[model samples]
Target: MRIMLIGRWGKTHALAKALAASRDVELYSLMDKKNTGIASLSAHYELGNIKDLSVIQKFVEKHRIDMLFVVPEMSLARGITDYFNEKGIPAVGPSEFCTKLEGDKGFVRNLMKENHIDHYPDFHVFSDKKEAVEFIRNYSRPFAVKPSGITEGDGVKVMGIQLINKQEAMDYVEQIFDRSIGGMASVIIEEKIEGEEYTIQLFCDGKTVVPMPVVRDYKLLEEGESGLNTPGMGSVSYPNHLLPSLSKNNFDESVVIMERILDVLKEKYGEKYNGFLSGQFMLTEQGIRVVEINVRPGDSEILNIIPILQTDFMDICRAMANEKLDEIKISFAEKSTVCIYAVPEGFPTPSGKVQIHIDRKRFEKPGIHLFQSCFEAGESLYEPSPRLFAVTGTGDSLEEAREKCLEGLSGIRGKNIFYRKDIGTRDLAERYMKKYDLPGV
Candidate 1:
C-alpha cells in the first residue's frame, strides 16, 4: 500500500518511524515547509506546501497513494480529509466540521453540556471584555482564563507556573480581548478544577473506537514541575497505559464519554469520523474532566506511546480508512516509554545561531528512538534549528526508560541547549502515586 503522511516537526517524525517497519507500505511525507529531520527521514517527499490541497492531490496521483495519514490539526481544520473523501482517497483524520470540537472550545463545551457528558465543566464565554471583567471580578478562587482560539499553547492560563489570582486573571483577560492575541474575538473563563493532567488518545473510524495508551504529558519546563509551560517539555506512560493517580474505571469512563461525543458528531454531521482524537483530561475528584481535544496526535505524547505499540500503525490506518477498526486487533507492548524534548536554552523563545553535535550512534543503541524537530541535519551532525529534537526510550519500567532517554540526550553536545531532567523520573511518579491514595478533596 502506498501511504502518505501530511505533517511536519517531531510528531511527523515519530509517525514516520512507527510506520517504517510495516510491510508493503511505501511511505511519503508532505512537508510544505522545511523542518528538522525532513532531510533525513523522508527519501520520497514533495517539497511543496502541505496545506495546499493541490500539492497533496498531485502527490497522491503521481505516487498512486492508497492511504493518507493527515498529521496536523491545522490541516484537518482546513478540510484536508473532506477533500480526500471527495477524491475517493482513504485517510485517517477528522473532517473540518469535526475540528469545531477542537478549534472552537465554546462549541465543544456546549456540545458536552447538551449531550450530558460527565466531563463538561462550568464555564462562560464572552465576546465583550467589559462583561468578562465584571463576571470574573466576583468569581471565586482557582479559575482558568483562556482565549477562544490557539496561542501556540500559550492561550490558556490557570494556576500555571504559579497560582492564578484574580488580578493576574484580569491581566490575562486583557491580553486576549484587549491585545487580540491569536485573533481572539471571544474569551472563556472556566472553573479551574484542580488535579493531575493527562491526555487520552484514541483511534476511530466514526463508529468503532480504539484507545491508545493513556499518557501524562508534562507542560512545565522545570524538572520539579516548576517553570513556565512550553509546547510540551516531556511525557511518560506506564505499561498499563494508566497513570498511578488515575483509575482504570476512570479511564474507561472517560473513553465512554468521548465515544458518545463522537457518536453525536457522526449523527449531527452525517459523516463518518476517521482519525486520531486526543482528550486532554484532568483527573479531578468528580471524574475525568476533559480540558481539550487535540484533533490530531499529541506531540511528545506520541513519542511516548508509539514505542510500546505492538500492533502495526499502518494496520490501524488501513482499518480506519476501511471502517473496520473494530475488526482490526489493537495491541500495545507491556513496556513503559518516556519522551524528552531538547530545545533552545529558553525554548518557545527564539535562539540565535548555534551548531549542535549529535552522536548518530546513540539512535542506533537498543531501545532508543530519535525524532528530530527544529534542528536540521548537517553534513557532519546536526545544527540547532529552533526546537531541536526529542529522544524516546522504552524499557520494562518508566524509570529505566527515562534513564535511557537522559543518557541518549546526554550525547547531544551543544551550547544553550536545555531539556528537563525530571521527566519519567521515579521521584515524580511517586508524587502521583500518593494522589492515588488521597481522598478527593
Candidate 2:
C-alpha cells in the first residue's frame, strides 16, 4: 500500500517511523518544511504547502497516492481530508467541519453545554473586545483567555499563570482581537479549573472508538510547571496505560466522555468523526473536567505512544480509512515510556536559531528512539523553529525509562538549547499524587 503522510514536526516523523516499520507499506511525505528524519524514511519526499489544495492535488496525482494520513490540525482545518474523501481517495483524518472540536474552542464548549455534557467549564465566547473586557471585569474568579481558533498551542493565557489580573486578561483579549491571533478575531473566556491535567487519545472510525494509553504532557517551557505554554515540552505514560496518579476509573471516564462527543458529532451534527480524537482533561476538586478536545494526536504524547504499540500501524490506518476499526484489535506493549523535547532557548517567543548536534549511535541502545523536529541547515547542523527534536525511552518502569531518555538526550549537544529536566520524574509525580490524594505516589 502506498500512503502519503502530511504534516510537519516530530509527530509526523513518528508516524513515518511507524508506517515504515511495515514492509507492506511504502511511505510518501509532503511537508511544508524539510524534516531530514522523515525525508530519509520516505520513498518520495516533497516540500510544499500542506494547506494548498492545488499543490497537494498535483502531488497526490504525481505520486499515485492510494491513501493520505494527515497529522497537523491546520491541514485538517483546511478541509484536506474532506477534499481527498470527495475524490474517492481514502483519507485517515477528521473532515473540516468535524475539526471544530479542536479548531473552534467556542463551538465545542457550546456544543457540550447545549448537550448537557457534564464537567464542562463555564465559558463565554465573544467577538467584541469591549464585551470580553466587560465580562472579565464582572467575573469574580480568575479565568483563561483564549483565541477562538487554533493557536499552535501557544494562544492560551491563564489568569494566574500568564496573566496577572483581570485587567491583564482584558489586555490580552484586546491583543488577540487586534492581532487576529489564531486567524480568528474572536475570543473565549472560560472559568479556570485548577488541577492535574492529563490527556486521553483514542482512535475513531466514525462508529467505533478505541482508546490508547493515557499521557500526562508537560506544556510549560520551564521545569516545575512554571513557564509559558509551548506546543509541548514532554510527556509520560506507564506500563499499565495510565499515569502515575491516575486511576483506571479516571481513564475509563475520559474515554466515555470522548465517545459521547463522537456520538454527538454523528447524531446532532451529521458529521462522522474519524482519525484520532483526544480529550484534554483535568482532575479538579469537583471531578474530572473536560479541558478541550483535539482532532489530531498530541505531540510528544504520540512519540510516547508509538513506541509501545504492538499492533501494526498500517492495519490501524487501513481500518480507519475503511471504517472497519472494529475488525482490528489494537494493543500496546506492557512498558512505560518517557519523551523529552529539546527546543530553542526562548520558546513560545522567537529567538536566534541555534545549531544542534546529535550522536545517532546513542539512540541505538534498546528502547531509545530519536525523532527530529528541527530544520536541517547543514551537515550535522539543525536550526530550531521552536522544537528541535525528541528522545523517547521505554522500559519496564518510568524510572528506567526516564534514565534512558536522559541518557539519550545527553548525546544531543548545542548552544542555547533548552529542555525540561524534571519530565517523567518521581518527584513531579509525587507532588501531584499528594495534592490530589491519589494512590501510587
Candidate 3:
C-alpha cells in the first residue's frame, strides 16, 4: 500500500519512519505547507500547501496515491477528504459531517448535553455582545471563553468572576466572534468545569472503536502550566494501567464517557464515518465532562501511544479503508511512556533566536526516544530554529520514564531555551495518591 501523510511536522516524521520500516508498506509521498523535511527522504514529495481541491487532485493523480494520513491542523479536512472519496481514494479522517464536531464547538456541546454526556456547566451561545455580557456578569464564578475555530490553544481564555467587568466583557464578546472558519462565527463561552483534565484517544472505523492508553497531557508551555497553552508542551501515559475490559479499577470512567459520545455521533451521523476521535475531558467528581473534540490524533500523546501499540498502526488504517474494523487486532504494552517538549523561552509565542546543542547519543542511552521538532535532518547537531526537539522516555514505571526524559533534556545545552519542568507531575502525583487512598485533588 502506498501511504501519503499530510503535514511534515513531528507526527508525520514519526509516522513516516514507522510506516517506512514495515516490509509490507511503501510510503509513496508526504505533503506539507512547507518543504522542511523533503531533503531528508529521497521518495518524499513536497506538495506545498494543500489548500485547494485542485492542488490535492493533482498531487493524488500524480502519485497514484492510495491512502492519505492527515496530521494537519484540520481546516483542510473538508476539502481533502471530500476530494479523496469522490475520486475513490481511501482516506482516514473525519467526514465533512463529523469535522463539524471539532469545527463547531457550540454544536458539539449542545449535542453532548442533549445526549446526556457529562460536559461543562450549562451555557448559552449568544451572537450578540450585550446578551453574552449580561449573562457573564450575572454568572456566579469564572468561565472559559473560546474562539470556536482554530486559534490553536490561544483561542481559549479563562476569565475570573471580577476580572471581566462590563467593559472587558464587552471586548471579549467581540474577540470571540472575531474570526470565522467554515462559514460559522468563531466563538463560544462556557462555564468552566473545576477538575483534572485528560485526553481520551480512540481509533474508530465506523463500527468498531479501539481505545489507546490513558494519556495525561500537560497544557502549559512553562513550568506547572503557568503560561499560555501552546500546541501540547508534553505528555505521559501508562499502557499497563489501561484496562482491556470494563472494570471499576482498571477501566477508566472517561472511557464510558467517550463510548457514549461516539454512540450518539454514530447513531445520528450514520455508520460510514471513519477517523481518530479525541476528547479533551475534565475528570470531575460529577463525571467526565468533555472540553473539546478533535478529529485527529493529539500531538505529543501520539508519541506515547505508538510505542505501546503491539499491532502495526498501518493495519488499522488498512482496516479502516476496507471498513473491516474488527479484523484489526489492537493491543498495547504493559509499560509507561513520557514525551516531553524542549521549548525555548517566551514560548506559547515567540521570544527570540536561541542556540540549541544536542547530544543524540546521550538521549538514546536507555529506554528513550527523541522526536525532533522545528529542526533539520543531518549528522552534525545544529540549532536550525528555536524549538530544538522533543525527548520521549519509556519504562515500566512513570518515575523511571520521567527521570530518563529529564536527564535526556538536561544534556541539551541551549541559550534562552526553556521547557516545563513538571510535564507529568500532577498526573503522576494523582496516580500515586490514588493508590494510597489519599487526596489527588
The TM-score leader among the candidates is 2
Model 2 spans with C-alpha error above 4 angstroms: none
The per-model lDDT (C-alpha) reads 0.80, 0.89, 0.66
Full ranking by lDDT: 2, 1, 3
In candidate 2, what are the lDDT values of residues 50-74, reduced to their tens digit?
Answer: 8888998999999999999999999
Quick one: best lDDT, which candidate? 2
Selected candidate, larger TM-score, 1 vs 2: 2
Clashes, model 1: 1
The TM-score between candidate 3 and the true structure equals 0.86
Q: Which is better, 1 or 2, measured by lDDT?
A: 2
* Residue pair clashes in candidate 1: 32-50
Q: Residue 137 CA error for candidate 1 (Å)?
A: 2.2
Clashes of 2: 0
Off by over 4 Å in 3: 33-42, 160-170, 179-186, 242-253, 351-355, 363-366, 375-388, 425-441
